[model samples]
Target: MTATPLIDPFQRTIDYLRVSVTDRCDFRCVYCMSENMTFLPKKELLTLEELDRMCSTFVGLGVKKLRITGGEPLVRRDIMTFFQRMSRHLDSGALRELTLTTNGSQLEKYADDLYAAGVRRINVSLDTLDDQKFADITRWGRLPQVMRGIDAAQKAGLRIKINAVALKGFNEDELFTMVDWCAERDMDLTFIEVMPMGDIGNENRLGQYWALSDLRDSLRERFTLTDLAERTGGPARYVRLEETGQKLGFITPLTHNFCESCNRVRLTCTGELYMCLGQEDMADLRKPLRDYPEDDRALENAIRAAIALKPKGHDFDYSRQKLDGQMPRHMSHTGG
Candidate 1:
């Protein structure tokens, strides 16, 4: 039997859940994490079986869309096993969609398996197409390897979307180039504003910030953008390019917030439920999951309790050249 749908205090039905399978990644993007960082110990992470149970519980509570994220989800050991396990929910019609966000580093090895497991679309974090700039942006990423992975994923018939972080003075020159490239390859693109998170100093955060409004104005010089009244269950707002007929998305957390229509929550690999991305409030679900291993009643109650405390909106601000409402946790910690 399906449990009652999870709803927040503002009467928003929580139907989407983003699960972090691991806290480790192969690349350390400049805006995402520090060059030299320490990752979580494997012992602290929830086992694959435990993750399956937790996600299944969410499905039972009417979570229609599930997105598996990570520092890089594909890099986790035996990660496809988790995708394969979750496919059961998709097959049973309890879950509407099952997808993931990756860095495109491991897609070459797992692309076929991901398609087999019911992932029709995926988001790949690619900041720059220039090899040298790509290397600089992702401290440890090789542009050629990522390109090969993208090729493999395309060959495996997975719909790809490129997610780029808009950094001032970094990829401003390649804005048009990126749009043309995605149009040629039949892939959608989204530009995200860098959020104030992790070990970033105020000076660095201020330096890297790029407003999407400025970006939109730049594109208007060369293209016609038509606003689309559709959302993909995430924070991105879409606009269709009249010339290319391809969709472009913008995630502007600083200039404009999308928390009013928020219907999602993030779950860390350690069973921590983060109600909002820009806020520090979270609930530890690990204890309840382990304590009531045989019965899911306590676990469900805990999830309900957490949802009841969900805030109406986040307070991420970058006004007057000051960084405010910055979270201490790294983006990778909660699976950006």
Candidate 2:
């Protein structure tokens, strides 16, 4: 039987999938979520078996790249075992790349195990280099611990990328320092413009949103950034450093919308398929997956129906809407 390929309304081939294993995290970054919050119950989250089945279905559909994300993925119990189970697909050439996006708190403990389980690429979230600033932003996170995790990942031979959320009053001063830090280690760094997601006190965070265009201009003063013809399956735009030979990326969803080239979809921990991060269009996959666990045809049809309904682009105009509605915009909940 011939399988149907999953293409969206924009004719973009959907080959990338970001799955949120859990919405729980150790650090509550100011830009991501508020300190006080409610998380989904364990029963509500998709089990390992269910996640494996869903991943297999996506792989069969046409997904080549799979990224395991979380509020913090490492915090999920026996997540390495889950990765090991999925690694079989990578070993069998069923999937092209298996990657993880983590908070780096538990990377030191799981880096080696993760590599052994077929995860070769990792993106660690590190906003400020300053310890005090880190604590201030994350409320109770320790910079030293995250630093050790990054070091451990490098030692484990994993390709590391530092993901920094660009906030105006917070980490703006450290942008150049971050570039130099990545260059010294021969690592790639990506700066993402803070999006108005969820109820993380948008009023307080509104002043912190920094545009990527301005950030690029700032980089030009210190270093010459040569545009690199590279696509990473996600929204980031890659560039090469003329002097240090290092690579830098920008994910400017707010200032510069890259929705036209958006080739990925986010699956929340609770099994909701979010077509766009900025919009409220989502398909409930948990009910379908749970209702028809033995019916692969039913599961596949549900996913295909959702993918067919993916919009051309997100309606994210900050000037008009503040994203203050009851929609789930929390990055943790949406598998950022």
Candidate 3:
């Protein structure tokens, strides 16, 4: 029997799913988290088997693209085993693409294994290029380690994309440098505007939110950017350098909104299905999955109900005065 396709109220065909394997991370980036964080207990996280079942349900509902994310996905134990299990779907015709987003702190050790498990595309979150500045932003991150990880991933025959969170007074001056760096390596670079999601203890620093429009204008001064008409099933809008074959992307949630075309949903490690990143609307999948472990129909019904309730757009107006506790979920918990 054919299952019904999952569609939001706005008629958006939801096909992309971002799954967070764990909320634990080693770095405490100023923009991502507070100095002190309380992570979820190991018992509270979804087991590998549960994740597989849920993903299978999503795939059955016409989800073709799956992205594995986390506070840092590599921090999870036996994650490669999970990857191998999911690779079976990709091996068959059930799945189209399987990608991952990581901080690149531990990619050096697991890059080969990830490739062997059928992961070809990767996105690494790197905020700065300077070692000292990297350490400053990430609290205790070593720039060399991340750089080594990037190199290893490239060597392992993976398509690498650098996800840089554009923060003023930090790496804003190095935007052109970053472009050049990626161009030299034939890698695609994406600059994301720092979002005010969650209590990262830096709400007062909202002035540092760099608009993507401004970044685009700045890049135009140096290089010719030709907009690409193709969509990668993600929020980022891609462009090509007229002089070189390098591609650049911008994720402007603050300056420019992309919610009208939002075709994805996020699932936290504990089975919470977030309909939108900037809103508090979610469906509790853990309870249903736990209670009806063998009932695929129940799981699909819960997910479809959540999709039906998905909001038209997020209510993140950055111009408004700072409210008390705007966002309830942090980036780590929500799988940013």
Candidate 4:
């Protein structure tokens, strides 16, 4: 009932799909967002059925992993109904694993139903441990709500990934504290080096982010840190506390760009296919899905054309430069 999965001229089998359901988000993270973002009109975004058709095509091609994201995926109106449709379309076995990344503002209420509908795991974006510092960074801080979402996810039988963006002067001191908080709950914590995304000329931008090596050294002074080989297409490299069973992951995108094994591709909320995070070029998917609904070949061909154009990687050096100058869309918008 499915066609072969799409593959590019390079012969890499395209399988993973990260879809942005909506550009609307509840929070404003400094580094990855731009306030001036004039959102796409509602009629332009892919409807549920249209999105399902694309997802089915990808699954037929060879996609085994599917992740739902957004500026905050939960911010999409009627999100629960969307999940139900996606769940019925793919089922648990059709897609190897289905997951989502949320800002945690609404997870407390919907976490259980989200899991019931087919999401196996949920990752929450949480920057700081201090309430005031959290507010200062997110502009509204809502740390309590974020924490409650974490608890809700744990209770819903979903594996938790607490994503922490390490800021140097803000709350970098609490990196291990954040780790311990998750360790106590048996959840994993990943510390990301705030990536330089979006327009750098924007005003409310980030200052400096902590480096991975430096964080390892600091954590070693207190807890015995050990390396683990587990990793994925994601930017984070894993480390664990020797005695506490606490794990830490470092995403050093700014210093060491991991582009060689870049096996994934992204789909924006409006249906454009972006090959890399740093590049501006993208292929239009919405046009074909609507215009050539009967032509599967055309849709697959367009995707291949985009894949052939995937750039090598990004150019970033935190020591001498900052990636904060010109931001791409917000991280939420890009499904980060």
lDDT of 1 by residue, 210-252 (tens): 8999999999999999999989999999999998898999999
Clashes per prediction? 0, 0, 0, 13
**Could you say which candidate leads in TM-score?**
1
Question: Which stretches of model 3 miss by more than 4 angstroms?
Answer: 321-325
Q: What lDDT does candidate 3 reach at residue 239?
A: 92
Worst 10 residues of 4 by lDDT: 198-207
Give candidate 3's error at residue 166 in angstroms.
0.8
Misplaced by over 4 Å in model 2 are: 319-328
Model 4: per-residue Cα lDDT over 1-336, one tens digit each: 445655655566667788898887777777656544567789988987777778766666677777889878887877787778677645646677678888899998899989888787777888887888878667644988988887888888989888887777777778767877888899888888777666634443345667877878888888987888986556678887887878788877776777666667889888898887777778998888889888776777777788888777766555665443344566666788
What does the lDDT read for residue 333 in candidate 4? Answer: 65
What TM-score should be assigned to candidate 4? 0.91
Better of 2 and 3 by TM-score: 3
What TM-score, computed on C-alpha atoms, does each candidate reach? 0.98, 0.96, 0.97, 0.91
Worst ten-residue run, lDDT, model 3?
317-326
Candidate 3: residue 269 lDDT (0-100): 98
Off by over 4 Å in 1: 201-203
Which stretches of candidate 4 lie above 4 Å from their native place? Answer: 1-11, 35-37, 89-92, 200-206, 322-327
> How displaced is residue 312 in candidate 2, in Å?
0.9
Ranking by TM-score: 1, 3, 2, 4
TM-score of 2: 0.96
* Residues 1-336, model 2: lDDT tens digits: 125778988798898999999998999888777888788878999998889988888888888899999999989988888899889889989799999999899989999999998888999889989999999989879999999999999999999999999888888899888998888897899999877777776445457778888999999998888998899899999988898888899998766778898889999998999998877889998887889878778878888899889987765545543543234478888877
